[model samples]
Target: MFKINNLSAGIGGKTILKEISLDIKPGQVHAIMGPNGSGKSTMAGVISGNDNYEVTAGELLFDGKDIKDLDPEERACMGVFLAFQYPVSIAGVNNMVFLQASINSIRKYKGLPPLDAFDLIELIKSKMKLINMNPDLLQRGLNDGFSGGEKKRNEILQMLCLEPKLVILDETDSGLDIDAMKAVADGVNAIRDDQRSFIVVTHYQRLLDYIKPDVVHILKDGEIVMSGDYKLALKLEKEGYGWLS
Candidate 1:
């Protein structure tokens, strides 16, 4: 469902991802593990159409079409959802209002009618329940004054509601306690099926214990240094990246 061929990218004048190639098939969950500054987050951002980085080489394709030129909103409309590592808190932006507009925009793009107020509320409630999120969250500004766990669960709630085909989770497990992590993982696992794909990016393998990636990749510097089945994550957990040196 997604392919990155010989992809190289950088922000400003510095290169971060170097000739990184990955193919995420439908229903496959791929986990990328690496140390700090290893370009994992950059890979997710580039795939999500973040304009801060320029693609220095190769192509990014989604569903067999080139998406290197598309904007972030266009990519989201195309079923690409990136749950950010650090969800920003935006004051004065009603959470429900933002989500309603977002879902409606995607629906309109697909030649569907905007969900009416009644239907929208129903959808929100169901998604909130799936992630065990508090409905009271909607009463506040988007992520404003929310705890780390609340923000992370809110991200999962958005992904569940959108039903995205390709989900890129950029360090979704960061700062999450065991219970919060389990809640997020359960929400992700609930939506897993044969037609959806996921890219799980993280620094540790503990998160993989819950999500169970089909493939595990170890990234070093700007390139994929090693990749294997789930055992690879276990190996990294024990050996760490020092073995590579």
Candidate 2:
């Protein structure tokens, strides 16, 4: 569903990712593991069309189309979803309103009719059940005064509601307790099907225990140094990244 061919990206004239290539087919879960400053998040941002990073060389293709020049919103409208490492707080925006506007925007882009208030409410309630989210939280401002676990669960809720084809979760497991982590993983697994793909970027192997990626990639210095199956993650857990260096 997505392919990156020799993609080299940088910010402010300094290169961060060097010739990174990856292909994610439908229903595949790919996990990117790396130490700090290895450019894991940079890869996610570049794929999602963050303007801060400029693609100096190579291409990013989504659904057989080159998305290198597409804006972030355009990429999102085209079914690319990035669950932020740090979800921002919108103090005045009600969660339900924010989500409905987002869903409507995507639907409009696809030439679909907007969901009315009643339909949107029903949709939100059904998606909320998937993630075990509190219905009351939807009435509050987006991520405002939410606990760490709550914020992460909220991200999962958004993912479930949007139902994007490609999901890029950048450190969604960070700061989550075991229960919260399982809940988020369950929400992701629940939505997995033959038509959806996932790119899970995380530092630890714990999350993989639940999500169970089809491929595990070790990214270092902004490049993929090794790619293997699930056992690779188990090795990384026992032996630190030093041996790979």
Candidate 3:
């Protein structure tokens, strides 16, 4: 469903992702593990259409189309949902308002009727239950007073409502407790289908214990140094990434 061919990107003339190539197939969960400053986040940003980094070389194709020049919203409209590592808090914007607008926008782009406020409210409640989130969260300002786990669950709630084809989770497990992590993983696992895909970018092997990615990739210095199955995560945990050099 997604392909990155010899992709290279940089910020302010400094390249961060160097000739990285990857293919994410439908219904497959892929995990990318790397140390600090290894450009994993950069890869997510580039795929999400972040304008801060210029594509120095290569092509990014989504669903068999060249989307290298598409804006973030454009990519999102095409069924790409990115659960950010650090979700931004927007004051004065009700959480439900943001969720409804996002869902309506995608529906509009897909030629579906825009959901009215009533339907949106119903949808919000249903998805909140799906992610085991509190309905009270919908009444608050978007991410304003949410704890780390709340913010993460909020991201998952959005994913459930939109039902995107390709989900990019950028360090979604960063700050969760074990139970919270399991909740998040369970939510993700439930949504797995033949038409959907996941790209999980994380630092620890704990999240993998729940998600069980089809492939595990070790990214080093902006490049993929090794690729293996689930056991690779165990290796990285026991031996560390030092041997990846």
Q: What are the models' TM-scores?
A: 0.99, 0.98, 0.98
Model 3: per-residue Cα lDDT over 59-132, one tens digit each? 98899998889999989999899999999999999998898889989999999999988888887887777678
Off by over 4 Å in 3: none
Q: Rank the candidates by lDDT, best first.
A: 1, 2, 3
Give the least accurate 10-residue stretch of model 1, judged by summed lDDT. 125-134
lDDT of 3: 0.92
Q: What is the lDDT of residue 61 in candidate 3?
A: 86
Q: Would you list the rank order by TM-score, best first?
A: 1, 2, 3
lDDT (10s digit) by residue, model 2, range 194-231: 99999999989999999999999999998999999999
In candidate 2, list every pair of residues with a backbone clash. none
Model 2 CA deviation exceeding 4 Å by range: none
> What's the CA error at residue 191 for candidate 3, in Å?
1.0
The worst-scoring run of ten residues by lDDT in candidate 3 lies at: 123-132
lDDT score for residue 9 of model 3: 97
